[model samples]
Target: MKHEFTVTSILEDARKKHDALMVLVEQNASVPFLYMDRDENIRDVLYHLYGWHQILSDLMTKNPIPPIELRPGYTWKNLTELNYKIKKEAESYTLHEVKHLFNQSHNHWMSKIAQLFDHTLNAAGLYPFTAPSNLGEFIHECMGGHYQWAIQTIEFHLGDPYLRPLLEGFKSLPEVEAIVLGGSRGKQQGDHLSDYDIYVYATKPIDVEERRRIIGPHVSLMEYNHQFFETEDDGVLNNGIGIEFIYRNLDDFKAMMERLFNGQVNRGYSTCFLDNLLTTKIIYDKKRAYKSLQDTYRFIDKAALYQQVIRQNIPLLYGTQPNYFDQIVKAVKRQDIIAVNHRLTEYFSLFFDTLFAINQINHPGEKRMLEKALSLPKQPKELEKTVGKVFDNITSGDFLKDLEQLTLDLIKLTK
Candidate 1:
């Protein structure tokens, strides 16, 4: 209820955060969290925070209270647009200038605030623009809120990238039975964008926390179980290496080997597991377990396998518009551009797999799906034309005829 209490409480939180940073400087002098989301450096983030303060400072000097717009012409109403603007403008300012602007703006705003009457701040409808919150509460959010953010940003910059170090330590783990490297890295087709497709096979469930600890404050975000049954996904960049981890328990995998590795049609996962077993180059296998995987998949019933997938999924490929082509039509008519694209994409994906099934081809993962399809022996003759039409999501008569013909051609290949 007291004006002094509101103002003092806000500053106390901000002042505490500032004091903590100063104490941190006494021990370790490394400036914290220079890197932010999607690898945006520290200077850019400061520029964004400082922009808000600068606007508040300008309004307070010209008029006691500011408008909701924050600036005369533009406002932070559209946050995504505001972030875009901040990023573009911040590029023009040096890191030093950003710091100076922030400091100057902070002083000017605080000085102006100190001169205001407690009644002018506390009384509602005084500033008709910011109705619900009078003025002190607004300043609290701008000042103390942003200071806490900067301190946290500094803390986030401390960790290293975690993937490479984690894999390096896997060699010493007593639980791990095999460490096999696969995907482009194993197939000798790896480029800069290629991820680490490493399989860490163990007899029991791999200890996740212990794996994270080996890197020791290096990992910022690590995700698991979304990609596969037992796996971890990390996009955190460290030492310029992008890594993806797959953990397979031998006790669990032994059950899946006959179905997944031997080309038994998996309703959910598809046939790429056979491709992985074929292409993987084992790094460290104490019992040569991966060799058995290769041997099992080597003599597949290619004709029988092709019949299984084609029969199951071909009905999906050749159905009428209400079932097949009409899905895209419904989305396009609704003007749901994302839905239109999604429908087309899902159709194309199923179409690709069906074509491979006809060829009895062990389709690799999505890395070079279309390219791989083009190389196969039993694919549709007008494949490139069909691919272009579907991918473009073009709803013309010629495109329709092309898609229909392609579907008919694929059905023939299956037979």
Candidate 2:
């Protein structure tokens, strides 16, 4: 029988447990850090985790590079063990000491990735580790997805008050036309709103560079672009920047909202969180802000549905939530076999379903490529056999014997 689970439910449970854990950590006498696992310390390790995962995943299919051997003494364990290893290898220090470490590690990995783009390496390397040519398009997926997870986990456990102020600051910007709070918390379904995911619509199309200056140093801007209203036959609107800016004024904004309400207007494809909601916040009139807020809520409800479809179809690219695979490894280390088994099943099911959905959605020309990349066989029975083999491997305890084994298996399979 197939197991059933909803992302919303998992997020909600994680939030509740995280909140409870935070309270315990605060009131307890011995624990020095707010989080039991010292998650902050592990940021560097997390970066490396992402790097290795991305590299190994590419190696498995595209380039087939020799697999890197896992270091000795590392083994599968519970979340605590993973955190301990991260902390142990990490330079000793308090929260203050590690604040810069995250950035340093991030830059280090980025630099390494940059090297893959060098002209000499581009042609010779087995697989380039850098992001795609359209970096702007992909960066949001990386930052938004990961940060959403990090913020949720941190807010649940750390209780940071800074989140609200950060959001309020964004809201205060005059240029922002609509702001959508995406994620598990947007619908108030018990998912923790850790990081603020704000979608700021400007009245005028600002140049990417200009938008950067406007957003300034406080917050890092991910992706910004001018969107054109278009039609299938007439083609995209070719209005100049000045005209586009003029069209974004209060009157045009109201007209746009009215069209949206009457089902006469539609926005382009967006992978953002707000797509799941049914409606969105509209700021047509400055005096009637409350009405705009109501509309915004409905718009978001509609958008949420869209988000669900995207997740269902897309390859598992990024997640901020504690790496479920890593968590399983940690559980094994702590000798929590039951917990490891349960989580492993949950994660395996999610991945399988996600990949299967991607296969179903494959475009005509891309079907063969995807099928080959995913190792799907031509025959239905063959596909079942392959899936069964994967399940058996997951059930086997050989990978759980040590960190090295676990990492190797994960790198091989997840890739």
Number of the top-ranking candidate, with lDDT as the measure: 1
User: TM-score for all predictions?
Assistant: 0.53, 0.24
lDDT, candidate 2, 1-415, per-residue tens: 2223233433344345434533543343232222222343234333433433343334333632234222223322233344445555554554334434444544453444444332323233334322222222122223333434444544443322333333344456666554443222332232221233233445654345654453333343333343443200111111211011111343454555455444442212221212233222221223444344344633233333333433442232223346555676667667776787787655544443333333332211211322443564221223434444434655454454342332233233333
> How many residue pairs clash in all the candidates, one count each?
4, 33
RMSD, each candidate, Å?
19.6, 24.2
Instruction: Write candidate 1's Cα lDDT for 1-415 as tens digits.
Output: 5344254565566567645643543343434332223114566656766776765566555654444565555554444445556667888987667767766766666666666666666777665444566667667666777777665554544323344346568767888888766788656567778766777887776676776665435544556445555466564445556656688876566666566535566641266776777677665666766566565565545576667777767666567434556676666667677776776767776777787776766667777888888888778878887777666745443466677777788888866
**Residue 236 lDDT, candidate 2, scale 0-100:** 15
> What TM-score, to 2 decimals, does candidate 2 have?
0.24
Model 2 misplaced stretches (Cα beyond 4 Å): 1-172, 175-178, 182-197, 202-210, 214-254, 260-415
| Predicted model with the maximum TM-score | 1
Considering only N, C-alpha and C atoms within 3 Å, which residue pairs clash in candidate 1? 32-154, 33-154, 33-157, 321-326
lDDT of each: 0.63, 0.37
**Which segments of model 1 are wrong by more than 4 Å?**
1-168, 216-230, 233-238, 260-264, 267-269, 320-322, 329-336, 393-398
